[model samples]
Target: MESTQTVPINQKKTDKYPKSVPYIIGNEAAERFSFYGMRSILPTFLVAQFFNPSSNPAMQTMAEAQANEQTHFFVALAYAMPLVGGILADWFFGKYKVILYISLLYCIGHLTLAIYDHDLQGFTFGLVLIAIGAGCIKSCVSANVGDQFDESNQHLMSKVYGWFYFSINAGSVFATLMIPIIYAKYGSAWAFGVPGILMALATFIFWLGRRKYRKVPPSGIQRNNFLFISLYALANVGKKKKGESWLDVAKANFKEESVEGVKAVYRVLMVFAFIPIFWAMWDQNLSEWVLQAAKMDRTVFGIELLPEQVQTVNPMFLLSLIPVFTYIIYPFFDKLGLKTTPLRRIGTGLFLTACSFVIIALIQEQIDNGGSPTIWWQILAYFLLSAAEVLVSITGLEYAYTHSPKAMKSTMSAIWLLTVAVGNIFVSLVNSSIANKGFFAQLEGATYFWFFVGLMMAFLLVFMLVSGRIKERSFIVNEAEA
Candidate 1:
């Protein structure tokens, strides 16, 4: 049995890091730059850049749309597969081992894409491998941060998560700026190759932090956390009393440390149900959104911007806006006693997503009316969407970590990320159905996108209402400062 000391059996000693954090931040920045760089190029490459529309009459009608859908489907699959990877790491291989092996696979996946170049079969295989590898690393890296702290240094948890997210955005911003340039100049081979090299560097950095990392032994609890939680939730079904939320009953079953932890996990998971809808919309940037930009005149302020390059705008905004939101908006709200909890932030994010779609819908209306929509409209939408991402994605990460049992942290992180996978599936299914509908024929591109925008807005409203009822979990960060 665990004791009240709150220390795990195999916990390692770590310093309250002011400096070790920079290496993690730098590593994440480079890794994300590589991942996003390749991601930014995929849709355009698959669509007009690679596919031969003239040869396949059926494909010619909506080749770009289909290609975009495929991009989402594959990315979604990549995101989804990590659940398996996370499980394997937790139960068998251990996180460090999983991260190393999968990262190597990830590098290989990138290499396949670069080398296979013209071979469709080889390219698809490479993407799948890379996705799996990325999924594996994604599942563990954040949890690794948590491992670096213990009860004494737990105060630094917030700073660690902050830097973690900062690195992600930093990498994304660089990737956004550079990948498009690489694609436009050196083409796919070098663009994909660059990220491959960076993945290798990320692996090395993971080892560099090895001595400082907390090496908690596996729980040896044969029970699956999800199954256990599900049983507990089911037992209370239809047995409600006055003013008691399901979350309240769920929290009662957890041990003391996990009381707040369990509640946070449940709340995040519940909120997560609503997230896939937003992800469906957010992910369209590489797929449908970029395709839409293709039809627009790409000269912004007399500067030639590739349609793929425009995708970078969101990340750039994310990099700039995170600091603004963290320093300015979040504090401003906190000072006003508005209680900026994770649940509230996630709900607000859904609303912001709705507003983003509404803006996009307006832009589509302009195009339908024979008006040329300015690149500025898209930029405006990206700013709002990026803000929503900061609120949802970053908050969700911290929320997941705070809520999870120490032994199950990485698995829980994977569970939260799994929502993106669900959302991606929805994106692909919707796109495929719309394209297969055969309406508007030549105008299918415009028709399909507007359909998703409207649908996403409707879903967003539903999510906001559903999210409102989820009770906030009582919680505090437990890891130590160093």
Candidate 2:
């Protein structure tokens, strides 16, 4: 049965991508700009507005730490709720319809934040709505893009994924620079309102391409199973013992033996397992790491910059690095017979992330000795982290779509995001530990650094051991053709 359907389903149709892809990409770019713009200043705003930290120096410290914990919890829920949205998109509303519905809710979230800036209960409510709405929209939009192409134009998948990530960073870069400046000048009301406007624009742009999109109808088939295969793979802590491949277990349970899609599904899930640690660190941008930067000097050429403004460095570095990595680095490596596969890049990213933490630890020790660390150290750290992000975050996005079954592509994308949710849960644990306990009592202002460093070391060791045993399944359809 699988063999009969495989050729027809995967057969090449049209070689040209619908010209409307650029409109969708434009919409995503503006939407991301708005989201990151508001988010970039959230930690700083929480301390100053809700906590009233300025009156007391210690309160400032306490507020910053509390904000970190809240940020992690909020981001975790925001990323996690996408699975619920994905279920709805798969089983009920189709992807494009789901995106349209949720985008309005996202706009509402931004409005609430702008209007009720000082009301704690109101703000919390708004954040919850935004998280749910954003999660819903986030999962569906990317999957909607995949639905636009058939086997003939599927060769462009890599380019589409590349442009998708490029747009994200482009939006984020604009927001990072402009939002900080806006937050400093106009305060939270206008800063928050900006994203609402951009989100509205994004909605309009998505609609513009509605006619050109290849609408993949929702498959109503419901298959219930108890296990999450990614977690199951992670449960095997050590090397793959003889005849002990996780794929074997997956194959045994997957009754549809002829459908190679099931085999591909399990393989992707196992690779997905490697990314939890990377996300755990990636989220620190707005949480603990942002707090760390706040304590550092941010002056540039005699002009003092806001701490949040420094966050721009990552996106700026990313804008430059993406071209280098894609055009120069990838081509050079391909020529040398070097394996720069997505999974390998992700592993390398995890190690680079560990190195970022090491730099943080060293800088903290300097601050402990009554030495003011240069702003360049933070800039340097962002560069390293950005490089790591190029590998893990972008690769994860592409990997999620390629490996997902056609029937539940958006759902699987949400599951890939679930890894980020799990990572955020771990981050919350680390942040809460640092804030509430005396575990690193000797580190003083350096407690945050020490805590993260410990986590990174453990992640590096675990990633090294597991990445090797993981099997590769080709999903980039062009690899064979090229």
Candidate 3:
């Protein structure tokens, strides 16, 4: 109960960060540099460098469309694989071991790309490995951050996550800028090899922290696994003698802790239901947005810019805004008697995301109208999008970590990542539809951008309404302590 009490803004003392923080942060920065460095150049590489020159004009058009679709498919698959990784972490190898093993696989993936940059079959095989490796570690790394602290230092969780996100952007900022240049000037081998080298370094950095980390052992087999409980709940539906719901009956069969865990998960899932929509909008920065940039005059301040290089704007803003939000904006609101709760921040993020697409649509409209809008317009969109990312993505990490059951933290983290998977799948479908001249044929270009804006706006309204109804659960007590 004491843990549930809200500490006043000024009274909340900043906890000394864990010694392990630097190692984790260093590993994350390098890993993000590796991943985003490779990813930032993917769309252009697939569309331009991987084409079959012997194909007919119509086949060439189809091949380009296929390349775009395949890029989204790869992203979607990468995010989707976290489910497998999460299960492995929570139920088998635990977070640290799983991350270490998959990281090696990740390195191999990048190596394959460097070795076979010109071969489509080999390049794709490499992508598959990278996707699996990246997805596996995605949930564990964030959850591992939370594992580093307990009640004594819990207050600093938000700040640590801020730094965590800052490190991500820090890595991305450099990778997004430099990798594109490497890809354009020195070609794919150097681009891919550089990231692979970074990944190898990232793996080594993570190993350096092994002895220092506060590792949570796997829960092993449990009857209280979410899947088993859910099945039992369904099996026993309406079996209770009273007028109580099926869930209540199911709760009666579990220990008090297990019941509480299920309830917490339910609450988190309710919040997660709307998150995929936000992700759907957020992920476009890597794909559609880059495609749009390729058409614009990318010379800014006497420097020619690769289309992919524009992605640096996102991480640059993240670097600036995260500190502002952490030290200033959020704390200011806290002092003013306006608590910036995670859900509230997420809601604000959704609105900002919708607004970003509105900016994107306007920019697209100008492009459609044959007006060469300055690259600054796209920068404005990146600002809005990055702000939304800080609000939603960073806050969501905190929320998932704090709200999950002790044993299920990795599992919940995986669930959170699955929302990104869902979003990417949604984008893939949209891209497919537009490419195939199907249902979305009439909504190409600016209209496509406007359509997403409307969708996000609708999601924002629903998310706000739902958030108002769902009461937040108390933070989980550490199982070891309990």
Candidate 4:
């Protein structure tokens, strides 16, 4: 007897991306401008503008340290909230609706900053809201970009992700450059208010694409989610009665289709385990690096630069490098028979990040010795860091999108974002530990930057080893449309 089974139909191949991609890109540009603009000045704002000089001397004495700590805490919370946001999108509201609702909250958060720039109470509330709003949308927005294509147009995924990152840098470059000028010249209200306006525009642009988007609805209640499969695997770990592996025993609890999905999620999670350490180094470009800039002379060609404005270098370098790598450098390497695998690119990125910190450590040494290093040294550091970002951060997005099962793409994106959260948390903990312990007082200077370099180097070796051990697998197989 012969048995019949249903085969999944493949989407038709298309050379062009969806028309709605522009709307999403526009939304991202504006939203990133809003986010990075507000954040660009936050460390300075908390230390300078937010607190009144009339406050206690103790508060004034601790201002800089408090500002750094608060900045990381805020960023950590923002990244952490993606976990909840991802769950809500996957289990209930779907990506589009969740993004829409959260964007509104995001707008409100920015407005609160504009309205309450001087009031610590209102400012703190605004940051909290922004954290919630931004964190939630972070997962959905990236996954939404992936939802627009199937196997047919999937070849464009890497290019699209590159452009997506380009849009991010475009906005960030504008914000990091302009917002500081607005804050310095017009005061905090106009600076924060400008971002609010941009955020509102971002929300509207996202909404404009509603009809054109390919909506992936929630998975609804299912027995094969990661949580269930994980629990099942743990419960049956030693209870395998036959020759079945523990994973096979877990698979017995789900339909055939679900087994593959669970395996993909598990594999991706394994990759994610070591990623936070990379982010721990990357996110400092906004926090500690900016603080370092505050102590340096920030003038070039007779135009004085704000400490935060130094960050504009990152986006500027990214804007230039993304294309160079995509069109030239990567292809050259490929033609030379050195195909840059995702894991390899990520590992290379990790090493570059460590190198950037080494530069920072050297610069810090100059500063500690009472020598003023040129801001150009920091520019060089940003150059290396931006290249690292192009390799690691963008590739991670592409990897998450490509590897995730259709039902769990947003969840996987959330997991990727969670790495950033964990990294920020690590920064916060390190800051606190340094503050409390005199034994590690050396952490306050060049030694601290060197420590991260060594730490990242260690992780790079571990990442490469693990990447070699894991077999590459694709959960979805494309078939020509009938």
Model 4: per-residue Cα lDDT at residue 424: 86
Against the true structure, what is each candidate's TM-score? 0.80, 0.81, 0.84, 0.84
State how far residue 255 of model 4 sits from its true place (Å): 2.2
Clashes of each: 10, 0, 0, 0
Ranking by lDDT: 3, 4, 2, 1
Which model, 1 or 4, shows the larger lDDT? 4
Candidate 2 lDDT, tens digit per residue, 1-482? 35332235656556576676887799899889878888888888877788654548656555666677677777888898887777777777778888878888888888899999989778878888788887777877777777777656777777887898789989987887888788889988988888878988988888888887777777664553223433444455254467665444443334343234545666677877768877887788666566667677878889777788788888788888888999998789989999697777887788788778778778777876768787788778888999999988888777776665553354556678899999888777655665675453233466666666677778667767877887765555633355
What value does the lDDT take at residue 103 in candidate 2? 83
Alpha carbon lDDT at 54, candidate 3: 58
Decoy 3 TM-score against native: 0.84
Candidate 1: which pairs clash? 15-482, 16-482, 17-482, 150-480, 152-480, 153-480, 153-481, 154-479, 154-480, 154-481
> Against the unseen true structure, what C-alpha lDDT does each candidate score?
0.73, 0.74, 0.84, 0.84
What's model 1's lDDT at 137?
Answer: 72
In model 3, the worst 10-residue window by lDDT is: 57-66
- Lowest summed lDDT across 10 adjacent residues in model 1 is found at 473-482
Distance from true location, Cα of 275 in model 4, Å: 1.6
Which regions of candidate 4 are displaced past 4 Å? 1-23, 50-62, 143-166, 207-219, 241-244, 334-339, 401-408, 436-442, 475-482
Please report how far candidate 3 places residue 323 from its true position, in Å: 3.4
